[model samples]
Target: MKRWDAILTIDKLAAELIAENNYKGKIYATGSPAFDKFRDIDVAKERKRLRKKFGLSENVFVVFYAGAATPAGWQEDEITFKFLAEAMRKLQKKHPEAVFIAHQHPRDEKLGRYQKLAPDLKYFDISKFLPAGRQGKIDDTLLPMMDTVVGMYATNLIHACYLRISGVSILLPNAGGKRLFENLSLDDFPTKGRKNFSHLPKKPPPSRRPMRLKKN
Candidate 1:
């Protein structure tokens, strides 16, 4: 491994995975290339197009959720999805104009859950809205349009930070979990294997305001 060229990691999780595998190499955590790829996009135009495609208003508060790509047997992820959908339903009463959009894990393996869950909730799915091969564009566009993002641990959070979108991690509770809340950081993630929901924000937190990256 040392003889190979430099190892580039997209984010901290990738670096951690490599380290856990005991690969001692020159790993550069250079961030997501996807971020750089679509950084210069005309966001307003993309926002308009997406809203039109989803039948949503331009000024609606958009909450986007990112799902995982796992087997249908992954019960934990399914539970989390249900919990989030219910929470969003409760939130919609407060902001009727708010739109909830679900961005399935890009691999397409976990898209079925959305088909089953989105209709009753009246949420839109990014996979259904964007054409094939447009995942990068969707990320670049929707991350900026979203008011707050709810998802489990995923690289979407890194992109959210790149766009300064507020991301809330949904944690599974311990024991016979009845509720859950937004855990802002990795350290705040709850223990695995139970249902939970609580303390959700009606809008994006102040800390999530789009960042202005200054030159060093």
Candidate 2:
């Protein structure tokens, strides 16, 4: 497939894939320019400001669910939403300061479906805070404020990992789930163990080295 003169990739793994697939184009693993916003950010100060702006106390335990739109047969998004809602309900009973919030994928047409799916559980709609054009830029504005990010194998978890925020993936019971879990080290709780998420650290760890993707 010699279709182009050059290619730019987000990471080394992606560059390697292109080479492995026998693509003869010039490949550069320059990392994504989108991450530039994270470079000089004062995470602590920004997080505090956002928390105050959002009417959350400094000590609040913010659990953010990053929603994704899945294919028809793969109900991972719906399953994960219900699971997270129930889990958060139990978590809130124990920690009254814990706040659960969710942001749906900007492209997902079924907006506000989670409210109907889990009517008993209440969660903050963080998307409402986004400015008109910034709805798709949650990684820049909202992710740093989260104590923990939950999703069903969404790419936002990668951004969460970069921000030093704890990430969890509660995937569907299928081969795709197994493969995704193996690729990312985010905590994978079994069906029975999914009800409990008390092990998350109260505060995110200090900034460390960038994440290295696991090889299959």
Candidate 3:
């Protein structure tokens, strides 16, 4: 660890650890430049372009599900997907314009996790739109194009925060109630009184302040 002049991290836990350990190197928490890139985007403009390019109507309630997977096991990932699928189904039924877009984990594509978990989602229509994620350029622009972001524990929530989109951490039934973010659930989503997803206004609402950039 002493070989480097300094250390850089994006999370508070890491920065705390560095200080607690009394590392002699200079340490700085430079938030992900990748996520910061979309903070100041024109959300309404991006939404129009993406909808047109994807053949979606302006009124569609676009819900983006950013998938996550771990090498340890597929149990949690399966539960998360299943819950999201069902929740989206209900959301769509209540609002005919709703559309769920799946941003699958890049590795899940290779491992075919969805196929194995297929049996659990017998009645839910999980196939609406599937998009590639984590790709540098595409992901940076993708968050701005969505109406809302949903996921478990993933870095995409940070991007959602910067993009000023409402992000919800899905706490699936019977699974760990541990949350990555707060106050969003199947019961509360419908009552949030958010604007219609079909069309965006001339300007987007303000977002939380982004982490200031720092030199490493």
Candidate 4:
């Protein structure tokens, strides 16, 4: 920790932690440079443009599932996928304008498993639209186009929060799930609305429905 002349962090809390650890380096909480593109642009205009480029109408309600790499014994992924699939199915039936799309983690090899599990859900590969140099940074372009972002514990949720887009975190009934929420303090972050987090049961309830989005 002492080797570097300076350290940069995404937020003040992280900068404080580095300073408290007896680090001698200078600290800067300049937020993530990955989000620098979000600073000056007009969000409403950009969102419209991006949605059009992606073939989504302004009236369409888009829900984005941000998939994460899940190792063995981490049951959150399976639970979330099933829950979202069911909920989205119900939502789309009632609101034909609602659309569900997903992006899998580059390292998640079980992509086919989930796709088979939720055959109704559509997957979008943002890399196809991005230039090779920017392919790795899909969140910058993909997230703004979503009306809501859903995930188990992906950092993309934080990006959604910064963009003031609705973010939903599915909590599993296990210690791993508890620890992740405690470490991230996701509940502490302000969201677009109150119904951002969803607590799932061992089996998804047929009566349970996802939050409804108001059209722009």
Candidate 5:
């Protein structure tokens, strides 16, 4: 194993896998990435466009969410909703124009469950509104309008950090899970996951660009 080559790992299962191979490499654990991969998208433009198409004001804070939906690890699972509701309520209180836009887990069968919790959020499970190859139609359409993006235990968080999208989130992986294991050697490989992690978002845009900031 290369002294600088690290195995970004997650969970006891991953640790065991690495240990079994005697792979002497640095390991980085991050909150989660099952639903990660969105921070890499430049959805702010699409969000703005969608808001205009839907008659949303430019001042509105558009919080975006995309990624895995389960604690047990399914393509689409029911993870958490309380934060979304709270976010919506808070945004409404601070800026009534704030809106939450999200998508289903793409692999999920039950859309009703999500709708039941926050029917107002724009949910797209497998669209390009996030980051990836397909780059859905809505994604291009929705990116510009988003003042910010948001989610929990999502790869979208990573994407947000990637695209420099600013926002907030919660429900990260366990303390010792992916979050801790994924950045063991950030000093040597500083930008390693900085792009994606920066995408996780914050309540307000940071003082510095997500990418320009040091690894967390």
Candidate 6:
């Protein structure tokens, strides 16, 4: 693309970003995906069906941790998994009926420490259940149904936030250590019914360039 659109405080960030890095393109901030909430994916019947296939009980409290296994820049093996798995293990004592269902990214389920914890701990490779095209929407469906959704560094959290859900806990485990973006904190969130950041430049009405962008 000629000029890529940015998101959040990206316009200002782009100034410093462009100064340090060599690049060329228009940069503008696009808004958040949180507010654009859609209906949760339909999987209730299917989950029950799968449960029957596995001989699992009907009262299972499905806890799903499905997202990028090795999402981009973050070190996957260390921080994100470490804290999450540990937290779940600790959280399990109270929720004995809980059945932790994780969809391993890149087909690697059944990893370290996870294999040892008997019946309650289980790994689910969702790729088998969801077709490639429909996988993302599945995350949207499964998250809200959980007893509590707690994860670090995953896009599905955006959907969870959109639902304005309570009781779900989020743990941002950054190993290298940097603040992460929250739905409320990001410039994309609304303020007093107005946009959190700058308003969109109104379209030019068949005349001159936008008044804000025009120098004259």
- Best candidate, TM-score-wise? 2
Q: In terms of TM-score, how similar is model 1 to the real structure?
A: 0.55
Q: What is the C-alpha lDDT profile of model 4 across 2-85, one tens digit per residue?
A: 457998888887788777767777999998677655666566887898988877789989888877645643356767778778
User: Which run of 10 residues does model 6 get worst, by summed lDDT?
Assistant: 176-185
TM-scores, all models, native as reference: 0.55, 0.64, 0.56, 0.63, 0.47, 0.44
Can you write out model 5's per-residue Cα lDDT over 110-210, one digit (the tens) per residue?
Answer: 54556676666554343433457653323323444555655555555544554566755554344212343343433332344445444333222344334
Ranking by TM-score: 2, 4, 3, 1, 5, 6
Best by lDDT: 2
**Candidate 4 C-alpha error for residue 166, in Å:** 0.9
Model 2: per-residue Cα lDDT at residue 66: 74
Cand. 6 Cα-lDDT: 0.47
Model 3 lDDT per residue over 34-132, tens place: 755675688889889878877778887778777776553246667887777777657767876676656666555434454455433322223334444
lDDT of 6 by residue, 98-212 (tens): 6776544443343533334333454544445566775523545555455445455455555555544433334442432222322223322223423322233323334543336
lDDT of 2 by residue, 1-216 (tens): 355789887778778867876677799988776765565677888889889888888888998877775444235677667777888889978887788777676566776767778776657766667689776336546677889988886777877766778999775554225334433323323334433433333233455335689999
Q: How many pairs of residues collide in model 6?
A: 2
After superposition, the stretches of candidate 2 with alpha carbons farther than 4 Å from their true spots are 1-29, 70-74, 132-139, 175-216
Candidates in order have lDDT scores of 0.62, 0.69, 0.60, 0.68, 0.51, 0.47
RMSD of candidates 1 onward, in order: 13.9, 12.8, 14.9, 13.3, 14.6, 13.3
Instruction: Itemize residue pairs with steric clashes in candidate 6.
Output: 3-26, 41-141
Quote model 6's TM-score.
Answer: 0.44
Whichever of 2 and 5 has more lDDT, that candidate is: 2
As for TM-score, the candidate ahead, 1 or 5, is: 1
Alpha carbon RMSD to native, model 4? 13.3
